[model samples]
Target: MENRTPIPDLIRLATTTADVDTLLQMMETFCHHFSYPFDRPLRQQLIRQMLENPSLGSLWLVVDENRPVGYVVLTYGFALEFGGKTALVDELFIEEGHRGGGKGRTVLQQIQQTADELGVSVILLQTEKYNPRAKRLYESIGFVDQERSTLMWKRPN
Candidate 1:
């Protein structure tokens, strides 16, 4: 028999209550890595609220040996441009010590598979322009740069 290794079940949807603490810890790490200051209590409250609402978004925890090491968030939208449903990979973060060993690519592939299963016609994401390493990984996985438009955002005060 040919030697075959089991495919690891690393990517999984985060449970509303069961995975809240793990998700929060990963979110804090993500914010720190990207230099975004957040109010912990408010953030926690928001996450809890979102967990109760399925339409808000979906969060997945990347685990190894049943312990979470990273997370990804996908927010949904409906648009005629994409012919139906679309989703944005809002955030993807792998802990400091757990990075740079193909985990990122594995997680992305799993995301793609999940998108296919969820009837999402399009999956979108953006990274800083200067982050060449991330850009390369995204491209390697068949994500193309959209040249026709730029992403803009507005924050309500």
Candidate 2:
């Protein structure tokens, strides 16, 4: 008889400088896939800062079979509109081959559980309009379209 047991998905928080390399690799892969601009040095700095400061946010590695296959970033914030603590899913990416098999949704469920544990009132994320697949996934997971305000950003020179 052959034994079969389902492999449990793991979400491990990157809590030290040691994990930065894997996180960076995942980030680079994600950026390349989406054609998003990336500055390696600044990205490393930001990851380090987040690791050092719990209040800023968290970086997590999604592992299966002891190998990191993806990563997710959650940045914390305070908002009166949300009525308390809130978080933004800054980035979520599952490596090319590992996607489309429920990994992304599993990671999101883990994030929501963590948010509940931390008293986070809301979890927000954005996806490119051109990517209907992503938008559909988000919608399926209960994230509604925000019709009120357009998200705008300004960078200080």
Candidate 3:
């Protein structure tokens, strides 16, 4: 609680691991955006497995007035083209009930500050093609649309 603020608590990378369960629950709650495997234990295991990997990512929960309102997950990346480290904002979510109070913006600005502190040149993020609201939020916070799209392959197939 050292960096805790009145509305947006500022937590560093390492301090967030203890709240992994809350993070997992939040992900599961956003079922539309998440494909949950449906067992608490499995999710907990996956969360731990992720935390153990240095390159996997770090999660920060946005606690406001003592309750978690949103969260951010950032993973590191290197771009020889950009010539330094960049951060991929893998997931950012604010609960539906907490949607429009400027809390999201505050939390994101904190993320940007974190990126700056890490000497990262850019922050990469993506939103659903249909999530116009989210796109707008990101744009307002200086996140620009990348000229690229994602391509992927099934991991266990």
Candidate 4:
């Protein structure tokens, strides 16, 4: 039998302003690790928006023994191709110290279960090309590569 780490009991939704700071700190760490530029102001605004509107999305803090270990973000959208409501796993980060040991896999499994309960028809996510470890972890949890290229256009700043 394979030994697995039990899911922590501290996965809590970020529903209050008090959670913003903690989320920002963790997000900064995540972006830095991935070499993504951290736009603090924009991220702060987006986080607040999600908090104010449950219909928009949700943010969850992954905690272990009362300390935050990582965070996940899910944004809701409607997709005809998906047959209706879809969830984009906008961000999922497990701190370096907490990497491995089955935490990431467990969290993703929980996300799928939650999405099903919420009537989401599909869940989508993208990983960086350089981060094969993350891609493998996601695939191990049943996430598949759609083989479609993703393109984005940012509004002129």
What lDDT score belongs to each candidate, Candidate 1 first?
A: 0.85, 0.88, 0.73, 0.87
The C-alpha stretches of model 3 lying farther than 4 A from their native spots are 1-18, 33-42, 148-157
CA lDDT, candidate 2, residue 73: 95
Question: Model 1: per-residue lDDT, tens digit, 13-55?
Answer: 8875768888888888889878889678987887777678868
Candidate 2: deviation at residue 105, Å?
0.5
TM-score head-to-head 1 vs 3, winner: 1
Rank candidates, lDDT, best first. 2, 4, 1, 3
Q: Write the per-residue lDDT of candidate 4 for residues 31-131, one digit (tens) a residue.
A: 99878899999999999888888889999998888788899999999999998999999999888889887888877888887887768999999887888
Output the number of the lDDT-best candidate: 2
| Positional deviation of residue 86's Cα in model 4 after best superposition, in angstroms | 0.8
Q: List the residue pairs that clash in candidate 4.
A: none
All models, RMSD in angstroms: 3.1, 4.8, 5.1, 3.1
Best of the candidates, TM-score: 2
Please identify model 4 stretches exceeding 4 Å from their true place: 1-10, 152-157
Question: Ten consecutive residues with minimal summed lDDT in candidate 4?
Answer: 4-13
Candidate 2 residue lDDT tens string, 89-119: 9999899899999898888878887897867
